[model samples]
Target: MEEKNMFCFQCEQTAGCTGCTGNTGVCGKKADTAQLQDELTGALIGLARAVDDTSAVSKKTWQTIIEGLFTTITNVSFDNAAIEDMIQKVRAEKDSLVGDCNKCQSPCGRTDEYDMQQLWNADEDIRSLKSLILFGIRGMAAYAYHAYVLNFEDPEVNQFFCEALFRIGYAESMDELLQTVLKVGEINLKCMALLDKANTQTYGTPEPTDVTLTVEKGPFIVVTGHDLKDLQLLLEQTNGKGINIYTHGEMLPAHAYPLLKKFPHLKGNFGTAWQNQQKEFDHIPAPILYTTNCLMPPKSSYIDRVFTTEVVAFPGTVHIDEQKDFTPVIEKALELGGYKEDQTFTGINGGTQVTTGFGHSAILSHADTVIEAVKSGAIRHFFLVAGCDGAKPGRNYYTEFVKQTPSDSIVLTLACGKFRFNDLNLGEIGGLPRLMDMGQCNDAYGAIQVAIALADAFGCSVNELPLSFVLSWYEQKAVCILLTLLHLGIKNIRLGPSLPAFLSPNILNFLVENYGIAPITTPEEDIKVLLKQ
Candidate 1:
């Protein structure tokens, strides 16, 4: 038997392994735990395969696939029992598809469970390419799942999700894998657009919302993650009960939307990035709610008060079903009684309030001002300092990166990672705040729109503009966003805390040669290189 250090390192906090190959992750995933996750993924692939044709996809199939994939995300579901239940659902869906296939006697040969190990341990180049495909699809699935919960579903996005999963299960060869990688980007673009539409249409375009870090006294719930619908439901259930709701992590954007912000009891933000949850939620005098991913296992001090809705699940935490009844969570918040007096918390940068909702619509509406500033040399460059945050000490590079950017430049940031510096009062340039918060991770769509609009206004390709991407990636969402940038032919992107463990040298070389993607160095050196460009 091969002796191994706990083989798990797919996250910012990997154990000794570059990509956790052993019986447990450094984060505490047991070997059997890892195997169940793989099995759940395989079952999802089987369900995807069963939907080889469009006719085979039902609402049930899409829900199962999305939930199954979400369950496999790091820290979301660690329970073997939950994973087994999901596997059974996937099998049942596959069975239904087989029944239909048998009646028609049409063997598509498309439905089959993929051995995830094939992608994990393939030839380096093929593994990198396939990893991009699989990870991108997983990230895109999260967005689609959010839209699904709001009763808004996109047929093209849903069908392509299944198609992508099917290919991941069956495709072979580096060339084939490379195509699948780019296709993930293409489909993710549509999926993001669909989500943007769903979010805006449902909640109205996010505006410039200045959310305070001050937690109002009385019972409150701190809701975290990317699900606006879940937050809205909580707000609704807690309304008039004197229980205040606070947004946390990606849910911070919920404070900016008109539909959601209308809740009188929806107070302000709580805590910073997801990684800080263990400390931030310690002995918190409120019931905390997790609506999506980036959930660390709760410490015992606060575990009893944590509530999960949607796809987020941690064993022993209460799970809210589709009805969205948040009574139990509300009851917990009231029981905790919160702080005796209003307590003020600050962002990592010590700013009392962080501003968000400057999405594409908000930014583009001021296009004339931005264009004039550029023409007048008031704005010399645009820097998109965005991506996921990790536990690496080097992540301080971002804070330093934003700090060192030339005063004449504008910084556009998105994702929870931006919480590192978004609260800093970088002030403004030419009537625009130096750093613009462009909503959540999915709001990378907003950043892309702003770029395209700027390109159009200047009558040049987006690449021709003086814009540079300094991204920090920690998960599959970042994977899909990077692929989108590549799909757009955008170049000269600086990525860190580290290049993905899945990116082989050959594939990395391909990206370097074609897209000029490079690992981030020191902020001082990166600023010099970006300014030189």
Candidate 2:
């Protein structure tokens, strides 16, 4: 391992299903960028230690921690300069908390910055447990950051971020770290709920709406990533500017929010999932604005039109700052002038349109209908097929799995993964679409609400209900959501296309024995096993 320039396995697409240990990662991250990210993480850990050992934490302190964590998420920040700036910000925050610690000669090492290499090279079990805590919070931080952007702050969630980082950097025992790992899940549930409240209260509960796949003529901007506030701001700024706005990747769910979807020029979806961006965005006439993660290193063909905001940063791309002004993106869109004609695009399933919304509120609105339909044996089972999508092979299993679901089952999906089958129009059950898109990755909160409500309505625990979790994970957000499901005591979850490389044999066995967690098999076998058919 010392022979390698860097080691990273945080994402599912790591090299060789192990770790990315080269001059560049499979995600196109250079060794230098990876090194800077590690430095940023270490600095963040140091800042957490400072906050842990100091007085009351400030909002700015939590914001720095959240932004630093979000920046290290896969594909979020590829710019060396941006990462370096974050590292400095974290270090400065630590310095402000533990002032003059550097001047002491008899210094206790309690406030020292952690060396991430130590964690990377620790005992496999310890590393695996800490990885869960680290990666889980990294995902949770994205949610927390989103909520924070909407002026919604939860002190418990903020405090836990520091606690988790302190534990990640210092905790040595596997049991201690494992406890923290589950706590990550526990706290992340709360964090997600905070975010859910912020989004719904601010933007209005999402309602089911059909989104087209066509890119209308004239100037247009393609907004991607998971920030609804950023989307709203862009929508506001671009209003009456004669420019159409379309969503891409995880931002596809933005169409369902009442406040966001009301804009007349908020057009439709532009492309498929984030993994296909390089091809889908190639030579496109519109400028693409990334408000958060899932940003690939743009190809030279469309690099000029790439605009990023918030924690997402790629070198040479135009970035929207805290002011939230999107003039550059608008100007670029106007200059490109979009398609000559309205271009109709189809999803992977060759469908011209896809539907979203169907949040927990929307789905549970017809609670009596769903409960009655279940009692009458009209709905046999429920499958929550959701999570991130990636370019990894064997991901076609999701498409096949959704397609092969029984006609009597309701297949609920969320996040970018739905791009595979959201267009397939699985017909309907009790006037409800068999395939329901429940917004972005963060909408796992809504899914949980739906599951719990169904369990209560049926007079059974969620585990005892006719519900199965067939999840596809690609990055850290998926990690936290899976942890949340485990925290809720849900079991028999089929996870794929591949397990996390960070999971040691011992940790993996623990999950399998206690939680019924297993790698996904073929669609037919898994469907049978899950349904007992």
Candidate 3:
């Protein structure tokens, strides 16, 4: 096969639904940017080998691996310079551990950096399994990094990062790689739980709260992505400065945390999901600070107001560093001067306000009420219509799916996909809202907890309960979450807008035959099929 400028199919919106092999990908990643990311991944694989060889791996080495994986996630880093620097850091970490290997006359190839192209060009099934392990860890790294930012550390989670990367580079057999793939899911479950604990313990468990779509008059900033620690820091710096903060994308759930919402100026939400940001932020009079992934290339009009922090870097955007001082963002908001009058924004469904914060703790607190509702025949079924949102055409399936859910059933949603139908008032079943907004994508762990409690209450397994999972995915974070679900033996999951391009025919069939995972059909048809079960 002839070499291409670049190759990527790790996202749902990959070009032609096969691979993005051109000067740029469908996500606006340039060929040079993609090349640099692959180099960085290669360097990280080397670092993992170094860690495996040496027992003296420091805290910084683990942090480097986590940050490196997070940086390669889709829509996170597009700046070649930032990625180049990250590659250097990864190599430096490896050199620190294995410096003496350079002097050895008979150096083994074990510590050599594995070229990513080899895996990309491997057999189709091997490629599929390896991609699952690589992409799943990329997503899990984001969760681990968030937990680390809150001063939380899990040794098992950290060690698994190196172990998984080593497997990605060295494990060659189908069975060996497949075991590692499932292990990614197993480790990510604990990573997500660590993040959940870090978040709840740091900011208090989320409670149901109503966040408006209105942006009040005067200066304000829009914070997007998944990092609550960055939001907390920005909120602290902006306090008493007369500047309000509005949540966007996955940051919308931050309003449910007790410590964050206590600030009067941590006002309502601003826009819809991340995919809509280019349109929603066009010429808007505020600076947007991106704390993690889901950052689209900015339009020329709004480029100046884009400020990135942590690993979310686009060329030419201002970035906040480790000091966590948000003065630059605060100053940009002040300079924009905001609107002369208040601006009322609604979600895609045109609702003036939306309610969130039904995390696992909040939901489980009323387990008796929920079980009674289920046993008394008041609630017919539960639908978990969640995952990331993208610009792909068929994504409207999620909106239509929720719209068609029977009034007797309840809809539980998370991540940005909820933006599709979260604003619609599904009314209530018993005292619970028919549509419950579980926190962010990481909150899927909470959703699992709720499902288990419900299953235990009815003296049945989760598969036997009247529950369905209809997920729409965009990037690797969704990949990890889906793997987590599959690892738990959950069956009959309907995935859309399209199945992942990375899954080979054999692998896809395996999931279908064993796990009952299938591409979503029309909302009307799927609803009927799920209800009859």
C-alpha TM-scores of all predictions: 0.95, 0.99, 0.99
- Candidate 2 lDDT (Cα, 0 to 1): 0.93
Cα lDDT tens digits, model 1, 308-386, are: 8777777898999878888899889888999999999988878999999899999999999999999999999999999
lDDT of 2 by residue, 1-533 (tens): 13349889999999999999989999999998998888899989889988988886789999999999999999999999999999899988888888898678898878788889999999999999999999999999999999999999899999999999999998898789988888888998899899999999999999999999988889999999999999999889999999999999999888888888789999999999999999999999999999999999999999999999998998888888999888899899999999999899999999999999999999999999999999999999999999999999999999999999999999999999999899997899999989999999989999999999999998899999999999999999999999999999999999999999999999999999999999999999999999972
Error of 2 at 305 (Å): 0.6
What local distance difference test score does each model get? 0.83, 0.93, 0.93
Candidate 3's residue-wise lDDT over 155-183, tens digit each? Answer: 99999988988988988888898888888
Error of 1 at 137 (Å): 0.5
Relative to the unseen true structure, what is the C-alpha lDDT of residue 88 in candidate 2, on a scale of 0 to 100? Answer: 91
Residue 432 error for model 3, in Å? 0.8
- Cα distance off (Å), candidate 2, residue 504: 0.3
lDDT of 1 at 481: 88
